[model samples]
Target: MAEVVTSGAVARTVEDLSGPRGLPVVGNLPALVRGGRPHRTLEEWCDRFGPTFRMSMGRTPAVVTADPAVIARIHRQRPDDFQRSAHVSGVIDELGGHGVFTAEGDEWRRLRKMATQALNMAYLRQYFSTITLVTDRLKRRWDAAAESGRAVDVLDDLMRYTLDVTSGLAMGHDLNSLEQTGDGLHRRLPLLFPEIGRRINAPVPYRRRVRLPRDRRLDATVREIDALVRDRFAEAARRMEGGGEPANFLEALVAPLEGESPITHDEVFGNVLTMLLAGEDTTSSTAAWAVHYLAGHPEAQRRVRAEADEVLGEHAFPPDPAAVGRMKYAEAVVTEAQRLRPVAPYIATQPLHDVTFETEQGPLLVEKGTPIFSLHAYGARRDTVRFPDPEAFRPERWLEGALPPESLPFAPFGGGPRFCPGRNLAVVEATIVVATACRGFDLEPDHSAGPVGERASFTAFPVNLRVRLSARR
Candidate 1:
């Protein structure tokens, strides 16, 4: 309904997507590098030039969209037109061939379908105890610190919780990551995961040409994790052969799919590695943001605690999935937190074939091989058309239906068919973690650091968060 701005009238140097660029080959690489976080800069571009816009990341042409309709059409209606970027695809291939997250085409489809079975509505119930167990452990750690009259590094503790939950789901066994120490195999896995993502995204020639020190370390870590996963799969296979009950995701995956390899040894390893890496960091970051925001908003925190008390009552953690579902305010808090701080800020997609589509605004024609990125979590949220007073944290907006569900206005978990399969798990994990923490812990913002900010790595996390926590009075 509002007039969309164009690059001609705007002061920015990058070429606009709406019109043919009158620019040179070097493209916007220099400007992109100077802009610091690329997602924020892309958001600025969307603000200046409607939802669909363009820029060049090096010689590669990139189209960015904030409009939900455009994103949906691109991902659902015209999915065949798009493919994972070569950079991302190559990285995945190197990590593990055709793992669900990395694989495309039939390989991705089949693997995703199989993976979903483990994470489906039915299997999720099995994780309730694990989530509660891990969160309860974290609460005790925080309580111990409170008794000692010491400040807690909430980030570190939350990561421990995430690692424990991830290990439980992936391996059918808890690693007690919250109590883990030493630079041994268990610790190396989490450390290497995000660093691999960073290395993959890094524009380093040495990433492909020669092994950097970190690369070698990452390779060694992957091998170690692979061995662990292989051993687990072998044990599961033996148990299944001996007629044992299925207990974890690894077992489900290893179980047969009539026409397919139930799960290859590498597939098992890849899935385990994928789950461990993705599960921990993203949820941990979401939990971190949840604590940060609630601490800053006492009234909201009180409401969250009140709901937790009613739903979970006297329990140290959320009771069960059914009970967790009843805590609407808890869900809203996590949603709002994620809306403000999505872990994966921006995602890149390249088209396998040229495509054209029509929208309420106008027609879009993306040439074959063009790299398009959707800034799903940035200005898209703060955009007035998408969310009113978008900068403010108001959990009630969701209850009030201030924003439409179909709107791509806030895609912390992304949009379309490619929308994150793990989103449901993430929501559940965040709600329980935040609600339980508020019930027993008094978290205060670390004012000494001025304000907690972030560095966009594989996931966006608090760059230097130092918060003080004490027992709830």
Candidate 2:
């Protein structure tokens, strides 16, 4: 059995490590770009080459580790020993989203606390009503679909619900994307994560050299969203000046936008864009996947629905923030979904200096500036030793006292100082959506739509996961 890689041991350079063969110059770039499910490819490589092995992209040194312990160590290193890979940072910056997700060093330090606090549990409590409102809106729409005997476009509708909640709660802007006929932002959000992955992996950034029509369209959408966010900031500034208590996230984020505020317009605006893009896609997909699992596991669906009924009484959505927390079974469903079908299946990190990682396999020295791609879902999905019947969707595995006392391999939210700032909000938001779906409807797999499988843009989502939503017996 392979062991988690640790630090301090006799050293062997990456050149001395093992990996799949590559073309003279292109190396593994081809496999990454054209491969089926790049995350799964990395996981396969980890299984083949042991933990902490080397690969390259266009002749540039890259590393991959499937060991959860090494991934946790990499996370703890943070902006010091490692940081978000430059490729990812560049792509985010290109999209005009350079907030906590893309910030580094002093800038990261400055933005992290603010962004984290804005979505913390307390903030969720403050915004829970908005979530509940959006939840009801989604239920109303699903009710219409159920009444008509239609297969719900589960992923698309969930995305709209999350966007509606995020817009209302974060900026006091009623995007109401769920109800919007335009569907402009709705079209744009799904384009981003895939593009982020493409640009990051493309050996030469071919789109940048010769922009395609799709690229131009993406640029237009990004510009539109940016302008919309700026307008919201201006609106929030105006409201705060009128002695209105900070009503939404934007209002609370900016303090007296008139003079000498600690945060910059760009930082605040970037974070807003980040939240808008990240908030809708990740949680919605997570909830959608939870529904996907529930559709296949009727017993699990029953348990989740029973739990939601107990917590919610007769409410269509979580009645209060406290109630959201009390839906432990529903939360576990999301956790298990994250384990089996993590929205972020993998994360990219890099070594800031030459470093030695001691694996039970052995010690390997890695050089500075090497891009380290850690396939986090490998442990959650592949480690049968850690999770018996690893491929199974068992929400009970996440409940209190279900596992032994050891560091969890789950990295759905990333980990350490730079762990996802919006994690609490995402989980709470996803839990509410999942619980409501279970409580209000019975979901059955829409086999007529075709097979459902994992697709990765950046966050992995179930492709063709439409479901039949019917009122319960």
Candidate 3:
């Protein structure tokens, strides 16, 4: 591991870091374009340049690292000395605007406090019934596919399931995106995150200057989402006027506090959008990948099913927190799946001041505005130095008695203060969904749609993931 020099020491320069110096004007853009996925390209660069290196995005200087120590240090300094890169935050601002996810400094602190209160353990406990209801809808959808003996698009179903859960938890309403068809809001929600990702990585700020067809559609979609959220806020406000306590996240945000000023209407709208984007894509992607892994690994599947049977007995319909807690192996399975395929593949941060970054090679100086990309998925799961047989799915790695060392690179939900607050909810939701689905049916991958590949949208998710369900006795 690279050692950080003492505070007063001179910082290193970009020339000191190991990385390819591409064309004069374009820098690494051509290579990135040729390499397809940015994370994979960066991972390959890590292999060649050791754990830390320098790269460029157009004229902007960037540093890429997969070193856990370096990533931990960066995360620890978040919002103080290290903040979300301007490019990343700019994209999110355009999509969701100044919510908890995109806010920084005092604003971020305030939003985080409110959001954490709304999504805390107590609130999560209240969400179990809602989760169960959503899962029941998913079960019925899968059952129909099972009876038809046709492969179902698991990713699509899982996305719908998550959307339903998020809607119920965030707004106390049931969009029924899973059961309903041709819902404009449901269709548009998925596009928002991917478009944000596209704009963030685009070579030019084309959308800023002109509204292309896709940009026009995205604008319309965002307006629709805004209208829906605004209506929910109004409804919640009316209910509060009638002396009702807050029932959902929207209400929680807008409900008056004894001391603090009430959150503005715009804040409520922004945070609601944040919740939907954060909750839907990340949870669904992780669950779908877990299903994919379980489908391919029958032994693991059997173990999870057996564990689910013991924990859930004959009533696995609404997985209560207690029941989900008891399914240790099932939790391990989900953890392992997340280890292999983290939904949010990277964490991007920028230093607030000149900083010395510890790396495998040595301590390197990073300029204040340079974007630093920590490849979380690759670092935690695929690094040969940390995880043995990095490519294999081994749930035992996360079992209670067999857990890996805490120091090992295992950041599925990031690290430090910036760690995802929704992690517990995501894990619990995935565990319930996976255990329930596996208990009810055996899954077989439909590889005829071509190999199960990963596509990087707002989250990394399984692409072409079709699975045939065989009802279990």
TM-scores of all models?
0.90, 0.93, 0.94
Ranking by lDDT: 3, 2, 1
In model 1, which regions exceed 4 Å deviation?
1-27, 33-36, 359-361, 401-406
Which segments of model 2 are wrong by more than 4 Å?
Answer: 1-9, 256-261, 404-407
lDDT digits (tens) for residues 1-473 of candidate 1: 22333432322311334522424665665455343455666667677877777776556677777766766666674246677676766776687734777777777777777677777667778877888888778878877887887766666777888888888888877788776666666577667656755655555546777888888887887787777788888877777777765668888776776687667788788777777777888988888888888888888888988898898777767677788888898888888887887878777787787555454346565667787776667654667766778778888877786665434656677666667777778788888888877888777777675567765555667655666777888
Poorly placed runs, candidate 3 (over 4 Å): 1-11, 33-35, 256-258, 382-386, 404-408
Tens-place lDDT digits, model 3, residues 172-267 = 878888998885788778888888878877878877788999999988888887888888888888887888656689878776444667887678
| Prediction 1 global C-alpha lDDT | 0.72
Question: Model 2 over residues 81-105: C-alpha lDDT tens digits?
Answer: 8988888888888878888888888
Q: Estimate candidate 3's alpha-carbon lDDT, on a 0 to 1 scale.
A: 0.81
Error of 2 at 234 (Å): 1.2
The clash count of every prediction, one per candidate, is 0, 1, 0
